[model samples]
Target: MGVFGALNAAVSGLSAQAFALENISGNIANAATVGYKRLDTSFSDLVGGGKGAQPGQIAGTVSANSRATNGLQGDLQQSQVDTYMGINGGGYFVVQGKAGEVDGRTIFSGNDLYTRRGDFEVDKEGRLVNGAGYYLMGQPIDPVTKNVSGSVPQIITIDNSVIPAVTTDRIRYEGNLPTTPQTSNQLGGGDELLDATLTKASTGAAPDAAAAGQTVGVDAINAADEVAFLNTSIAGEAITVYNSSGTPVNVQMRWAKTFEDNGTQPDTWSLYYLSDSAATGANPKWTKVSDAQFDSSAGNGGQMLVPANDAMTITGLAVDGEVVGDMTLDFGTGALTQFSDSNGSAKISKLTQNGYPSGDLAGISISEAGRLVASYSNGRTRELHEISLVSFSGEAWLERVDGGAFEVTPESGEPIAGAQGRIVGKRLESSNTDIADEFSKLIVTQQAYSANTRIVSSGDQMLQEAINMIR
Candidate 1:
């Protein structure tokens, strides 16, 4: 029984070393794999006595198990691909595998798995899939409110279809209006600052009818008046606005100084836009948009006077016969001033509108905030999805599966939100396996296995000698 016991212990030692060697081999094999977590061998003695060792008892046999290194993070490598991502801290990307296809559409496995691998690319069916054939999951974002629409995560699909057109609802205008504009009329030695017959100068009434109508005209019949009108007004930067059906129309603006403060009335200016490019013979060419009131006696000489009523709404504004619905011309607070310019023009530093023509999807990328953003050919970007991340209390206890992913186990706690990790875009996480450490373990395991084999041989020889003595 002692010889057999010695042989049994030797065999168990050999088995334990073999198990450690297997783990080392696997670790070395996956050293270059992305997001691979290496397993370490853990040995335990399986003694016969539970409380304490008996007198003269032999060393117990060995049992081996695997230890996980899931909590250890890998180094991040930047990639040129826009969709690739990496985690900076503790979390896993929630992903699902592809089960099959039905009618040219991919069907998911319906099983939620966790992984650190982020080498993902957009597939032909518009699904964002990793190299391991797992689909990324996220929640759709509302385009209007710019918020996640759902709480549960679903497989993310990139829609390449043309984005619908958004009509112009607001135009942000910011610049300094010239205090003394160098209009053609002013440069050409005009004795009068403004020609009241041509321009609708404010008449000091609360709602002057003439100030609200026919600010300027460019009709062919009054071709000479058109030239005079152009000479009197200073040109403003032109901007393109989109209509409901994605039709673009150019809106050219002009600013005309209507009245200077004569101690009785405040200094006023009328803004007009080209309404008809092809109008001839007694037809309206330029239409009035807004009447800007300024405080000429203020410290800065042309600070805007009205704060509460600064913005002007252009109702049913038509440019070249394209009817654009009511849109607000937002002159931001303290944004408009009457500073002197060397060129004597409205230095429009920022003049942009909130409208875009229909466009096709140009590209997609992951953002640092874990948002899947899609950019369009029309120079517009929209938030499509919010990437989902989860963490487990016992992450190392997760069951390993194919493709370096993990499944929930009895020892591993359920996945929870609010991980301590942040998403890094355009980067990939390398495997955590170290080749040098594996090689060192390989040498020790080889030596241990060899020693166990010698013990087994000695035990066999002792048994043979006992048999010979009996004979």
Candidate 2:
């Protein structure tokens, strides 16, 4: 019975060694697999049941258990693809498997799976899928609301549809309006100088020609008056604004120093825009838009006073048979300033408009916040969806699935929703398996397996001796 027990123990040793070897081989084989977690074999001794188990009399059967190093973080490798994403810390990307096609739509199996693999590519249907054929799930962002919709994550689909044109609604202008402007004589005199100093009067009336200092109303300035005072009083600024049909129209604007206070009152300038038929008709040639009043004591020395009601609106705009709605021009507090400078040129530091022409989907990229941003041919970017990351309390206990994915098990707690780790775009996570460590384990497994075989042979010899004695 002792010899038989010894033979059984040796057999158990060989089986345990074989199990360890299997895990070692698997680890070495998947050393280059992306986001692969290494498997390790744990050995435990099985003692025979007895009242007082002696050292040599006890059965020593060994059992091997497989454990996963799922908690280990992999090395991040830079990828050229813009959609390639990697997790830097502890977390996994929530993914779902495709069940089948239903009514020409790919249906998900509803089984939630977690993985670190992020090698995703857009399929023919514009759905983002990983190498393992799992679809990436995320929360869709509402374009109008600019908020992520829904608490539950759904399969993320890229919208390749063409974006329609949007009419210009608002124009933000920021720059320095020159106090003094260099102008040219539009009259017959090719090189004649005109007085540049602006004079003011008590009431809105025509300036006295003979009076040394006089005030002239901006509305009273006609085409001939504009030409006469072009060099001295007014400066023009023009920009192209888009209409509803995406047609660009040149909007010419003129600023005239209507009222100037020597030291007491605030200086004021009247704004005007050139009419469409101004070149052929209209004596004044331009229509007044608003008045920009500068109070020296208002803000940081002096600043333009924006109407308390709202920004100034330009209405009744028509360009090339296309009618455009009113646009608001807002000069933020302290944005427009009056300072003494040699150049009277109005410099536009920043000018932007919230309008774009019709465009096609150009490309897609992953943002730092894990949102998928789509770029259009019209030079616009829109956030389509926000990727959600899930974390588990028992990550190591997750069941290993195909393609480096893991399934939820009883030991793995429920996934906590939301972002769990910092997202890195245009990168991929490499396998956690270390080749050098695997090779070392491989050597030990090989030696251990050989030593177990010798044990079996030694047990066979001992059994043979017992059998020979019986003979």
Candidate 3:
């Protein structure tokens, strides 16, 4: 080749090799960088006329070129992307600036932008921002307080309905009131009834319990199952005990309804005393409650609101806020529990009023189509929101921005809306560069660099030979 031609060849070789080396170094440096693509070098032949000096000969800058190849990605790939513990899809997340937050940017509605990195978290201000602090985009919802802010984080609201359990079943006390020593067990729960009243320590009055000629005796009542309780003569009826003054001081209510009316009481109800007792006028000791007390609205008897949820017995005072006795009826939840003798007779004293079973939070996972799900304590996982993925034909076409984000370029061709990539949850898609590939390209580029150096040397020798003209 002529001296000028040889020199031109050497110059082009050096330029190509330098460019290839630079690209190789860039690949190696970004080996750990996420979403980094690998680059490759290309070579071709160039020739002048004169039959092109042999078809295979190379010349000038036509020798080689370098570029990146397509990795054939962007299908529905479910990779465990961990940047955002909640992201379940491979899509570009959008963000908008809230007035002074950025240059006045917003995700969906504001100056919309695109991003691939999914590592996202909530900030102190409850902003759904990315790892680089770029805010993610979303709409507003007012669930509880019914307040909405332009820039608020998103959270799923759980629907917790509270319906309490109540006590059901009647308390039955049959036959004429007998003298003290009454022993019966004919109720759902085993409990003893106290026919006698004692003088309150605070009050020296009540005609004095022991002074009324009222003899005290130890009488007991026990719990019985539903079947055995049915067999008992005094079953299904509740009891009532008035103070020595004949005032209905305490009573064990029975019967619970199971039908719920959205936190409202049901219509139609009645109260039955399993062991109803009345003081005989023949006894001058305890004050006798006249028949008027039993039939009058304000007389000596217990009142109860029937719950439609369960047939068990509940307290009447609970419906009103005036609860009494050692037992506490939880009518708010609508659960019913009652005291009973072994023979099914309603025993007034032994009812348990409070105890409930509670349900654990499980774990977190992602869906194939990009859904963030949170497992609940009740073995339930709810779909928070569908994940969205954004893809552009050419990434380099994106304009580099401050947030490790990209500004759309005309060439990137508006993100193709799709979510067909394999999305792996709880995992991250590390940088795409392969060390072996980078090193191999580095070796090749290095050799090309050396060969270019040799061409420059050879050109210099040829120039010397032609210029010296010693021959």
| Top of the candidates by TM-score | 1
User: Model 1 lDDT vs. the true structure?
Assistant: 0.83
lDDT of 3 by residue, 161-202 (tens): 322222222322222111111134213343223222321221
lDDT of 2 by residue, 304-385 (tens): 7645443678776654345667888766656765555466556667667777788899998999888999999988899999
Please give the CA lDDT of all the candidate structures.
0.83, 0.74, 0.42
Ranking by TM-score: 1, 2, 3
What's the TM-score of each model vs. the native? 0.88, 0.84, 0.48
Per-residue lDDT value at 6 in model 1: 81
Give the candidate order by descending lDDT.
1, 2, 3
Task: Write down the TM-score for model 2.
Answer: 0.84
Decide which is better by TM-score, 1 or 3. Answer: 1
Error of 3 at 356 (Å): 13
lDDT (0-100) at residue 291 of candidate 2? Answer: 66
RMSD after Cα superposition, model 1: 4.0
Best candidate (score: lDDT): 1
**Scored by Cα lDDT, where does model 3 land?**
0.42
Candidate 1: residue 155 lDDT (0-100): 93
